[model samples]
Target chain A: MVLDGIAKTALLGVEMGMTLVLVTVGLTLIFGMMDVINFAHGSLYMLGAYFGLTVVSVTGNWWAALLIAPLLVGLLGGLIEYFSIRPLYGRNPLYHILLTFGFAIMLHGLVTEIWGGQVQNISTPALLDGSVDLVLFSYPLFRLFLLGVSIAVTAALWLAIRQSDFGIVMRASAHDSEMVNALGTDVKRVFTAVFVLGSVLAGLAGVLLGTSQAVDPGMAASIIIQAFAIVVIGGLGSYRGAVVGAFIVGMLNAFGPTFAPQFTDALLYLLMAAVLLVKPAGLFGNPEAT
Target chain B: MSVKDIVGRHFSAHAETDVLSGRVRLGLFVAGVVAVLFAPVAQMIHPFWMDLVTHMFIFALFALSLDFVFGYAGLLSFGHAAMFGAGGYAAALLIQNVTSSALLVLPAAVIIGAIVAAIIGWLSVSARGIYFAMLTLAFAQLFYTIAFNDIPAMLLGVDAVTNGDNGLVGITSLTLFGMDTGSLMSYYYLALVILAGMLALVTRLANSPFGRVLQAIRENEDRVAFIGYNVDRYKIVAFTISGAMAGLAGGLWVPFNSTATTSMLHWTTSGELIVMTLLGGMGTLWGPIAGAFLVVFLEDSLSAIGNWEIYLGIVYIVIVIFAPRGLAGIFQTVRSNPHPKVLLSRVRSALVTYREKVFS
Candidate 1:
């Protein structure tokens, strides 16, 4: 029975780990490329879930909304970047921090205002509705589906960023935007694409999260803090680091509760603090970046 | 005109003017305080407004302390609530366990705030910029959880410590020499005296060599380090001082509300102080006070309306976009203008040009 419980816990950990990996990778990509610490990343995720919820409610099809919601979020993100964040470029980073934070608050407030403060739950798709018997215990099939989706998404993203011509441009821009611009690449277009891509990833996470757990007004702040912690732990701007960091956090989140229920929530951050103290540059952070 | 020359000319013009206007500004500051002091009596019919002003002053202290870290030290702390919460907890605990003497509790609150700040400063000062901010925030959240979830059971038994989520109830009223003078009138006066003393200290410290060195560090930390200053030590000290002052505000809040809760230590509380400092204008001594007043008033009046968060979010967006320097920045521009009307016109034209060139 104890062994069964442990296996079940490990499975749950893997599923949670996948979700964190998705969110952290998107955040790291944005931060890596722009040197912009996006305080609004979680808001984008929340928006995705809300938008997905709205779509699902209308069409009564969860999978369709999951696919479409992120595209819409991506467009909105591009517009936000075009208007609000552009002015703060080359200014004090505090300006960016405040601007993004203000944007986040506005988004959260709007979400709360439009859709009352009540929590909304999204049912798992019909195909993944039941539990899968895993030897001695049963686990939710939808969680396994989420894990599969996340793995596919991560692999697809890796290939897209590594092999495509656009990836070449993106890498060059990330290394030195000024140099890329000097080389006559359309830097603005590249940045817009990257920003939208990052937003879509965040939206994807939100859709998956909404399906896995309930959605509510307060979820934005909670997820954002967790994402930030994940990013920090993973080594800012390092995609692989984000994946590794997310699993570590996920397993800790799942198991820490059984040991120290009260301090369970804090364990993730404590891990981050320890990691940071030991490796100030993070697990994957370039020493030169700091 | 080159950028350096223009900057030099601007400073030279203002340098002489400041010497002449110091007395005027000081007089105005005093007059402003006096008006605030008399406001309750003048508006005795509206205790609601008096309460709002009182709350504003309490928060203004919080904002000012935040500016010390943000504006002066160039550190954006996410855990400033540590000081604020520590102060509140200290005062509440002291009131409950030791004595209800306002004087004793007040000083004790500051000491408690300082100790908490010292601990946090030690942990956080090693970091810079966003890392520092996030770490502080993480620590602050941990502190909040400890207070809200863990402390009640561990420190004061399950029902004893904070009264749980219901919060500490029936805090002892302020008594000076066994006289019950703990009315709103007295609280207002007490807050005013404390605010005045704080402002005086801030001004003195701001003008002191220590303050200049801190500003220099803000401008160029590497350069400051090269000049043989212990950069980290100075940062720790400045952060500790700011934390202590925030705690002072927290301590005062206990009597002002006659209760203290874990709510005082939440990230939202820290965010509010940041907003106040930003709104009032960072770095300016009185800017935080003004910000506190404006934000508190806005929140108070707007909370009655549905979707006040939307309004606040809109306000924050607009201010950050248009008034990055905040209200005090506007004051500075007006004060500096040789011809205020012409300057206003020039600003308007400049805005139009900026819209055409960049924003639009």
Candidate 2:
């Protein structure tokens, strides 16, 4: 019976890990390439959930909303980059922090103003509503779907980055925007694209998370802190680090409740600190920016 | 002369005029003290205003600590509320379990706060700039979790320690040197004394060699390091001191609110302090205090109508664009400007700078 319970816990950990993988990937991507910090990433995630919920609620088609919500969020992200973020580049990094922070507050205020400050819920579509019966226990099918999607997306992302022309330009720009610009690349477009892509990924996390959990205004603030912890542990801007870090964080967060629920957040931080103590640059990160 | 040459020549001509800055500084100091002394009188007219003043002082304490980091040391901590919450929790727990003497408990809270700050600051100093900010934030969240679990009354039925989500209650008021801090007047005075004391200490530090070293580090960290100063050690010291001060404010907060809740440690709390410090004019001893008043007042006034956050967002944007030096900056500039004082011209410039930096 104990063995069965342990197995179930492990499964649950893996499921939670998948959710983290989605969130941290985008976070790692943006922080790695742009040096943008992007405090509003979680808000974008929250927006995705809200957007997905709204569309699905209106049309009663969760799948369609899942596909469309992130695209809409991408456009919003593009606009934010153009209007607010683009001007602040090459200035004091604190300006970026403050600006992004302002953007988060603005987004939260607007979200609350329109949606009200109450917790909102959306049902998983019929295809993934039921649970999958395992030897030990039953698990939600939707969670498994999320797990599969995250893995698939991660693989696709890896491929695109490895092979695509845009990805090569992205890598070049990430190395040095000034150099890339001098080489005749439209650095502005690349930055905007990367911003939108990062936001859309956050939006994707939001949609999936909303299916698993209730959506609320403060959700962005809480989730972002954890996402940040994950990225830091994974090594800022390291995609592989983010992937590995996400699973570790997810598993720890899931199991922390059992060991000591209150210290769940602390446990994540402790783990990060421990990793950083050993490898300050993160597991996958190069010590030097070069 | 060109603008640069003209400005440079005027600056050289007015080298002696900078001495008059001392007079403006003294005047501002007296004005500030007078305002604090008279501020509680507004409470007699309306108790809420007095309570507001008390809160403002608490925030001033918080913002000033932030200035030590962001203003002096060039470290932008996004998780300073951890210290604040730690102090609050310490005072609250002490009140609940041990002695209720405000003197013993508050100082104990500050000491404990300093210890926590030292540990977190030590770990975080390895990184710089945004990385440092993220590390501080992560450490704060970790600290928050520890408070929730390790401390009683925080969570997990540890009511004896933290009192959990319901928060520590029945916290006895300050009996400082045997005086009842329960009285609003007494509490206000206590807060005032502490705030003024902290401000004085900060001013001393800012003017002292340590403060100069900090500013030097801020201006050119690499050079300071090359000069053989363990730049990380200095950063850690500044971080630790700022954390302790943040804790002191937090400790006072327990008695002020009569409870210390987990909410105090949230990132928003840290964010608010950052806003206050920036709005007042970072690096200036008085800027944070001024910022605390302005921000707290604005928040209180604006939250009633909604769109408060948006307004604040706009204010932050505007400050970054126009008044990067903050309210105290305007006064400092005018007092230092070597231009000949003409009829209405000096007065108009002062007013513009003041409004541009402060009220705007």
TM-scores vs. true structure, each candidate: 0.92, 0.89
Model 1, C-alpha of B17: deviation from truth (Å): 10
Error at A289, model 2, angstroms: 11
Q: What is the TM-score of chain B alone in each candidate?
A: 0.88, 0.84
A65-116 per-residue lDDT for model 2 (tens digits): 8999999999998887776676666678677777778778778887888888
True contacts kept of 1: 0.34
- Candidate 1: clashing pairs of residues: none
Residue B315, candidate 2: Cα error in Å is 2.2
Model 1 lDDT on a 0 to 1 scale: 0.79
Question: Highest lDDT: which candidate?
Answer: 2
Winning candidate number (TM-score): 1
**How big is the positional error of residue A128 in model 2, measured in Å on the Cα after superposition?**
2.3
